[model samples]
Target: MTLIVGHRGARGEAPENTLASFAKALAAGVTRVELDLHLSADRQLMVIHDPTLKRTTGVRGKVAQHSAEDLQRIDARLGLPGWPEPCPIPTLEQVFGTFPDIEHYQLEVKSGSTAQSRIVLAAILQLVERFGLQNRVVVTSSSRTLLRTARDTAYPLATGLVEEYGLLDPLKSARRYQCRFLILKWTLCRPTLIQQAQAQGLHVSVWTVNEIEQMQRLIDMGVDSIITDYPHLAMRVLA
Candidate 1:
């Protein structure tokens, strides 16, 4: 069966990157929960999709500028159904603590800055070791350098997130990094690209795909996994 990865943990149904959203994704039967990580001012790995909290949380400025304590004071603006308590931005440790049974996790390193990248990488590696989850987590990023760093590390699985359509030979990069998968942006995907990736003995997947028709189309094209905002909707479509 094709793997169903919940993008930002049922983002369409709950606040992105919150524990509540992750629980919702698991409840929806999503095998993997995909989330982005940003390093805080104090080098704590915090789970949030955007570089700035302004868009989603009604806050201003970059996530890396604030310490974890400062982030805790900020509300995550949880707008999910039946949510009765206030939700704070969760740390990477908190996420693993809450969801021990999740089969796989796709951790996207969002910051491209040098210090931020190293800190984020170290923090994630620490967590993986702490939780004994080396075999269950995958590190991925659109930046070749960041992906290379993560891949070069001892992380069990690493993947390159390809968003460029004109990039020369993404498969080669994936192979160079020893990545287990190549995550393609939906717009740049084609049957040929999927076939090429598979022929190279690499796993293929796509991201941020919503809508039943699109999901079905990718499934028909033989995508190994699809990252979607609505895991429940994906389940219905797959059914």
Candidate 2:
């Protein structure tokens, strides 16, 4: 069976990455979830998709520039389902606290594999340790070097390689980084590729899948997990 991972916490039902979104996904019966992480100015690890806050938060600054206090006051759900109701951006700590039973959390780090981003990885590792989610989470990133650094940290969490720029053989990067998962874009999730990756002992997780036809196709192809904006629809499709 294909595991349904709520993309940005059932983004179709609620604002992306907000607590309300996560609650809706759980209500939709999704146990696995995919979220993005960016470090804030005050060193708080924030759970949001972009390094910049323009798209989601409607603010005109980078997430790393805002302190936790300032970020808390911003209404992340500007015009979404819970408009004007103050859905402040949540910390990874808050996420773990609210949903103790979330089985698999695929966290994508938004920073590149640069030297300075090591701080970002370190912060994430600390949070994972604090919440005891090291075993239940997969830290995914497009940067192979960053993943290598993460692996060197001796953290037990699974590492995943996110496909970028239409990577021809994402498995190569996964192998290089010793990643257990291949985070494929929906377009790259072909049956042959899925089978090949699985045959080589790699789990394939496709992302941003929302269409019923595509979901059914991926399920038929035997994907290990499907990250989607609509978990309720995914559940029905699987059913």
lDDT of 1 by residue, 86-202 (tens): 668899899999898788888887547555566677778889999998888888877777776666565454555655574667887888777787888888789998999889887
Which residue window of length 10 is worst by lDDT in model 2?
Answer: 78-87
Badly placed stretches (over 4 Å) of model 2 are: 79-84
lDDT of 1 at 11: 90
User: Per-residue lDDT for 129 in model 1?
Assistant: 93
Off by over 4 Å in 1: 78-85, 151-157, 164-166
Instruction: Please estimate how well model 1 matches the true structure, expressed as its whole-model Cα lDDT.
Output: 0.81
RMSD versus native structure for model 2: 1.7
